[model samples]
Target: MEGELQRRVGRNLRAYRQERGLSQEAFADVLDVHRTYMGGLERGERNLTLRSLEKLAAQLELDPLELLTERRER
Candidate 1:
């Protein structure tokens, strides 16, 4: 379902944001999105468009696939 994908992407994005030491506000600015929209995205309440994803990935200096990838367990 869309909700599940949102959660996955949201979780991944949150992790990536933390790893890069970005505050939600700062990251949102970098992505050219509103702070509340960024909050919604982090909460899995917003659906992501491809362009939005591309901008986010670019801001992170990452490939789009990297943002979409799940981390492996040891």
Candidate 2:
């Protein structure tokens, strides 16, 4: 369950970032995080804290819950 949630967050983050036309390195710069750390997050290899999640959401102009919620296919 934990791993699944991590992957979900990763997928959502990647999708949202792509939607904004940002590369992982650029997004990491916007978030003031390391590029490697951003890569880890996008790969679902790192666990995210609530505060970090909120920060990421805020940077993306998204509600924090949106990061955790599963996106439906069109």
lDDT of 2 by residue, 35-74 (tens): 9999999999999999999999998889999999999864
For model 1, which pairs clash? none
Q: Mark the regions of model 2 whose C-alpha exceeds 4 Å error after superposition.
A: none
lDDT of each: 0.81, 0.91
lDDT of 1 by residue, 1-48 (tens): 658877777888778778779999987887788999988998889888
Worst 10 residues of 1 by lDDT: 65-74
Question: TM-score of predicted model 2?
Answer: 0.90
Against the true structure, what is each candidate's TM-score?
0.78, 0.90
